[model samples]
Target: MSREPNQRLAALMAEAGASNKGLAKRVRETGLRHGRRVGTTHVTVQRWLNGGGIQPETASLVAEALSSKLQRRITPTDLGFPTAASSPVAVAPSYATSLPDTLDVLDRLAQQSLDDEQSSGVLLPESEVNSAVLSWLISHPDTLRVDVPAQRRVGMRDVAAIRTAGQMFMRLDFLYGGGHGHKALRHYFRQEVLPLLSASYSAKVGNALFGAATEISQLLGWTAYDTGNHALANRYLLSTLRLTKAIDDRMMGARILSNMSHQANYLGQISRATQLARAATEGGKGRATPRAMAMYAAHEARALSSAQDHTSAARAMNEAEKHLERADSAEDPDWLSYVDEAELVGEFCHCFRDLGRGPESLRYAERAVALTDPQYARTLGFCRMVLAQSQLLNGELEAAVTTAGLAVEGGDALQSARFQRYVSDFQRDVSSHAGVPAVQAFNTKVRDALADLDDE
Candidate 1:
C-alpha cells in the first residue's frame, strides 16, 4: 500500500527551522558521538519527510540529535516514525525498583498516547519484546516505600474507584471489542487515575493504587493490540509489567506477559512469543491459580504451534488441559474469570489449526462456538471463521461457505479491526472456492457488511 507523506515530521522540522542538510549533519554528528557511522544526507532526510522510514538505530540517533537541538525529549513517534524503531521514550530506573519512577514513565506514556498527532501503524520490534520479557523475568521485589507529597490524601475509596473503572472498561472491551471503549478508558486514566497516582498516600495505599493502575494499564494495552496499534500496546504492557513488579503483584505481571505473548504471536514473532509465554508461567508460579496457569500454557501452546513445533505444541496443549481440569473459579482472580472452557477451546482451535490438525481444529472450534457467550460477539465471530477454515481444510467446501456466512454475520455486530482482519483472512482462504454459489453469496454478504462497518 502506498503511504502518505510524513507531514508531521515535515512540520516538526519546519517548526524547528532545521533544513534537511542541517538535520542530516546533526544526525551524522550525533551518530559519531555514539560511536556509529551514519551515512545520512540531505536526500535521506528528504525521504524521511516523504514517509520513508529509517532503520531503528537511525531513528534513535535522529531522535537524540533532535532532542539536543530542540532541548527536549523528541521521540521517533513525535517525528512520525514507527515507534518500533525507538527505545521507550521514558523508562524507569529498573523494573524491580522505584514506584515513583515507574509512575512517572506511565504518566509520560499516557500523555503521549493522548496526543492528537500520535502516530499510527507503529509495531513493536521483536528485539524490544525480548528485552521487555527479560526485564520482567529478572525484576525483583521493591523494598522501598512510596511517600509522595500531595495536596490530597488517597483513600481506599479512591483505589476502589480505579479498580472499578478497570473492571468496567474490561467488560466493555470484552463485549464490544477494545476499539469501542479504549479511548474513553485512556481519558479516564489521564483524568481520574493519574491524579490518584500523584496523591498523597501511605505505602499500603500506594501499593493498592499501583496494583489497580497495573490492571487498567494492561487492559489499555490489550485494547490497543486488539485495535491494531501494536507499538502503543507494547509500551502499555511494559508499563503494566513495571507497575505490577513495583507493587510485587506477580500474578498481574504474568497476565500482562501473557497478553504481550499474544500480540507477539499475532505479529509472527513466534520465538519471542514463546519466550514471553514461558516468562508468564514462571512469574505466576506459586501465586497464579490453576485457571491462570491454563491460560498461560494455552498461550505457550499457540506460540509453539506457530513455530511449527507440533510435538512440543501438543504437549503444551495437554498441559494446558490438565491445568484447566484443576481450575476453580472461586480460587481464581477476577481477571481470570474469562478463561473458561470456551476460551481454552478457542485457543486450542487456534493451536491445532496452526499445527495443521484440521479435524482437531474443527472439533475445538465447534465446541468454542457452542460454549461462547452471545455477548462476546467478536470471539464468536472469530471462532466461526476458525470453524469455516477447518471445514475447508477437511474438504467440506459447502459447509465452509455456510460457516463463513455465519462468521460474517457475527463479525458484522462488532467494531474490531482484528475481527475485520479475521473476516478478510477467511475471505482469502475461501477464494479458491469462489466459483461455488454459496461461496459467491458469502463473499457478497461479507463485502456489504464490511462496507457498512466502514461507513460506521
Candidate 2:
C-alpha cells in the first residue's frame, strides 16, 4: 500500500527556504556529531519531500539538523513522520557489564534532555518501563573498574559535594515545589556532574560517584514530575534505576521504582503503577527500611484504590500502616526520612478519596493537614483542597467553600502543577453550585489567585 504525501514537511521546507541539497548536507553533518554515518543525499531529501518516507534514524537526524538551522525545536512528528514506526536508539542497557558503556548512556541522555527539540513531545513507552523493571529484577551486579585516564582525579570530596547538592535541591523542592528549582538542577547536572562521570577515579570513588548520580537523577525525575513533565521524569527515573541496580543498591532501586509508580498513577496508568509498585517491594526484599516498605505499600494502595479494587486497596492500606508502625526514623536512610506517619496518612487520604469514601478521606485529610510541617506550603494547600473535596462529597457545601477559599489563599506559594491540578479539580467540583453566593465567590478567588500565580 502506498502512503499519502507529507504536505507538512513540504510546507516546513518552504518556510525554512531550504534547498533539498542544503538540507541533506546539514543532516549528514549533524549525524556525524551523533556518530551516525547517515548516507542521505539530495535525492533522498527529495524523496522525503515528495511523500516518501526515510528510515527513523534519518528522520531524527533531519529533525535535529532542521531545528538547528531554523533556530527552534523540530520534531519528527512535525515533519509528518510516524513516530510510532521509529525504533528508538538503544543505549547500552543498564545491566551492561561495561562501566564505560553505562557512562556513555548517561552522557547521551543528559545531552538529549538538554536539547529542547528532542525533549519536547517525547514519551517514555509503557513497554520501556516494564523492560527496565524486568532487567533491574534479573540482572546481576557488574564488577566495576574506573581506571580510565581523564582531565581530573575525582575524589571522595567530589562525591560528597554531589550528595550535598542533592540534599539542598531536595529541600528546595519540598519547600517551594519542583518547579522552583528544576531548571537550576538540570543546569548543575550538565555543567558539574557530566564532567565528573568522565574523570579518572579508583573503584571506591567510582562507586560513590555513581551512587550520588543515581540519587541526583531520582530527584531530577521527581522535580520533572512535579512540573507535569512525565515523559522526562520517566526517562530520568529509569536511568536512576539502572544505576542503582548496577551498584547493587537494592534500597535505592526500590525508592526509584516507588517514585516511578507515583508518576505512572498520576498519568492514569493504573496498571503500570501497580506493576512498578510491586516491583519496588520485590526489589527491596530484605534490604529496604520499614519506612521504605511502608511507602511502597502506600503507593500500591493508592493505585489499587484508583483501579477501584477496594478489597485489595484496604489490605494494602493496612499493610502500609503496620510497616509504618515498625518504622524507626533514626535507622532509616536519609532519603527515606521524608516518609513519616503524616505522609502515610496523606496517602491514605488520597486513596480513600479515590475510592469515594468521603468520610474516611475527610478524617485522614484533616489529620494530614495538622501533621504536615508549616514549611511544606504546597503540601498544606493540597491537603486543604482534598479536605474541601471531601466536604463537598459529604454535602457540607458551605464548609467546602470555606476550605477551598483557604486553598486559594495558599495557592500563590506553590509552584507545582500538581497543586494547580488539585485547584482545577476543586473548581470543577463547585461548578454545579455556582448559583450559590459562597461558591461563586470561591470560584472568583481561585481564578484570581491562579492568574496571579501565572503572572509571577
**What is the number of backbone collisions in each predicted candidate, taken in the order shown?**
0, 0
lDDT of 1 by residue, 1-456 (tens): 886899878876886789999999989986776567899999999999888877866876676677556433355666888763334433221232245445545655565552234525455566765676677677676542456444678888998988888888888887778888887888788678866765678888878887887888888888888888777777788777877876678888899889888998998888888988989988888888888989999999999999999898989899899999999643865677788899999999998888888999999999998999977777888898889888888989899889878877765344777887877888888787679888889888988887877898
Runs in model 1 lying further than 4 Å from the true structure = 1-98, 112-117, 144-148, 411-413
lDDT of each: 0.77, 0.78
In candidate 2, the residue pairs with backbone N, CA or C atoms under 3 Å apart (3 or more residues apart, or in different chains) clash, namely none
The 10-residue segment with the lowest total lDDT in model 1: 88-97
Off by over 4 Å in 2: 1-102, 108-115
Instruction: Return the lDDT, model 2, position 50.
Output: 73
Residue clash pairs of candidate 1: none
